[model samples]
Target: MKAFRQANHDLNSEPESAASILQSVKEQELQFEQLTRELEAERQSVANQLERCKLGSETAR
Candidate 1:
């Protein structure tokens, strides 16, 4: 029947749809990782600056 054929076609298309969704998820994960690394580096730089400021203040006192 035509309905059965349509159902079969839909079943076959499922894997391609799943693959596209999985690929998108992977790309988003990579972007998240890169953003996390950049944030960590920024935090470290800020911390270093604060420490330098503290040391400078202590020397002035």
Candidate 2:
């Protein structure tokens, strides 16, 4: 009976452990997505600046 109770307790804890791990994974994914967006925005801004510089140089020439 004691062994059965211990096994049941372990089984119950397993789901909670899995849930915590899954939550952490989800949070990490969100952080990665946010970082990707920020990087893309930065890339776009740089491209725009480069285009402006090219236009200014052409006008000067």
Best by TM-score: 1
Error of 1 at 7 (Å): 17
TM-score of 2: 0.73
Give the per-residue lDDT of model 1 (tens digit) for 1-61. Answer: 9999999998887656768999999999999999999999999999999999999999999
The number of clashing residue pairs in each candidate reads 0, 0
TM-score of each: 0.74, 0.73
Which TM-score value belongs to model 1? Answer: 0.74
- Could you report the Cα RMSD, in angstroms, for every candidate shown? 4.9, 5.8
Clashing pairs in 2: none
Q: Write the per-residue lDDT of candidate 2 for residues 1-61, one digit (tens) a residue.
A: 9999999998887666768999999999999999999999999999999999999999999
Q: Can you give the lDDT of residue 37 in candidate 1? A: 100
